[model samples]
Target: MDKVLEGLKYAAAGAGGLFAYLFGAWDALIIALVIFVVADYITGIAKAATQGKLSSAVGFKGLLKKVMIFVLVMVGTVVDKAIPAANHAIRSAVIMFYIANEGLSILENAGELGLPLPKTLKSALEKMKDEKPEDVPAEEQE
Candidate 1:
């Protein structure tokens, strides 16, 4: 039992270190992104189940896409490091875009469940649709 506990501790430490290395320090933005991602996934499942469209394949694909989002964020972090002048700018932009995108998806899920959504929130997300990482300016990259 002691050996198993020690192994678990080591595994957790390794996972945490990898998360920090890839995502940088966990900030408010990151926390929000994580929450949004989870909420979106749960809502997606609910939506699919209600519509009788649930499939293991689709769920697995959604999981893969979620993992890919983190991978893309890691890529942005690496790119930011390559450009010494930029401090996490690419990563921040990438995360921000996903946050908004996931938030919109959640709202869509809510709407599917017959919940009313605010127009302003929808419009804000729509406006930010074009403000993705690639669309951000060099000056803002700092």
Candidate 2:
């Protein structure tokens, strides 16, 4: 059993290393995105459970979507690498965008679960959700 556990640990580390390589460094942005993604999924499940609407198929779909988020980030990393001038810009942008999106989903789930959010925070999130990339100021886009 100990040997098996050791083997599993090694395999997990190998997989993580490959993931980090493909994603272009496991930095704070990626970490925040992961946290938000997981939190959104958990809150989604909780909200579904409260409403008695849980379905295995829907849950599986959600998992697929979550996985695809990382897949997209990997693609972003590839794009950044291909463009020598990009300097991880594409990957960082993709991660940040997903972090914000997942955060909004989590907040929405919280609201559905009857959790009271601060008025200012809720309004700010709502405003962010409404804003398009083009709507952001040129200086802030950097």
Candidate 3:
């Protein structure tokens, strides 16, 4: 029992533990975000192939941006750690922001592939997508 507890403590000092701790979303958020990521990537690839502009560089950049969404999740975690009361709000907002962005990208990818998309979700995502950046004003830009 003592050995196991010590091992657990040390394991968390490494990247593998950190990755899980940081990226492991709650049950609902986990399902939704994982689905969002996979669907968005697949749709993006389809869009690229259809447009005859499939470059690995562009795809990689897109992947990096997607990865940054999770990085932002870690940002929320850090914020929560710093300010405990804001934990729930920060986590929800971060998840919502990424979900909205991913949802928008999925819609864009669909349009790029000439598929008809629902207007309402696209518009909602547009609004949600715009809100986050605007909330951080010029003074905070530094």
Candidate 4:
């Protein structure tokens, strides 16, 4: 039991390290992206179920796309690392783009389910899709 517990702890540590490396820092940007991705997926499933249009193939395809989002993030992080002067520029942009996309998708799914959305939030989400890191001033970089 002692050996098993020790092995589990090591495994958890390894997983945590790998997650940090792949996803970069766990800042608000990454956390929001993760939440948006998950909520989008759940809402998508709910939307399909409500409309009676659920299909295994479609779900699989959606899952593949979600996985690809992370792959892009990883690639962006790698590119940033390769360019010493780049301070997470690529990764931040990639994450922002996906976060907006996912948020929009979730809103769409909610709409399909007859949920009324706040106009301000709807507009904000629409704008987010086209946002770029450079568009914001350096003072608000944090």
Clashing pairs in 4: none
lDDT of 4 by residue, 33-60 (tens): 8898899989989999998999999999
Judged by whole-model lDDT over C-alpha atoms, candidate 2 comes out at: 0.83
Instruction: Give the C-alpha miss distance for residue 14 in model 1, angstroms.
Output: 4.6
TM-score against truth, every candidate: 0.80, 0.77, 0.72, 0.85
lDDT tens digits, residue span 1-142, model 1: 9999999999999999988888876789789888988998999999999999999999998888788888888898889989978898888888888888888898889899889999999888767655545785735321
Kindly provide the TM-score of model 3 when superposed on the true structure, using C-alpha atoms.
0.72
Best candidate (score: TM-score): 4
Q: How accurate is candidate 1 locally (lDDT)?
A: 0.84
- For model 1, what is the alpha-carbon lDDT of residue 17? 90
lDDT of 3 by residue, 99-129 (tens): 7778888887888778899999888877876
Give RMSD to native, each candidate: 5.9, 6.1, 6.0, 6.8
lDDT of 4 at 2: 100
Steric clash count of candidate 2: 0
Which 10 consecutive residues of model 3 have the lowest summed lDDT? 133-142
| lDDT against the true structure, each candidate | 0.84, 0.83, 0.75, 0.84
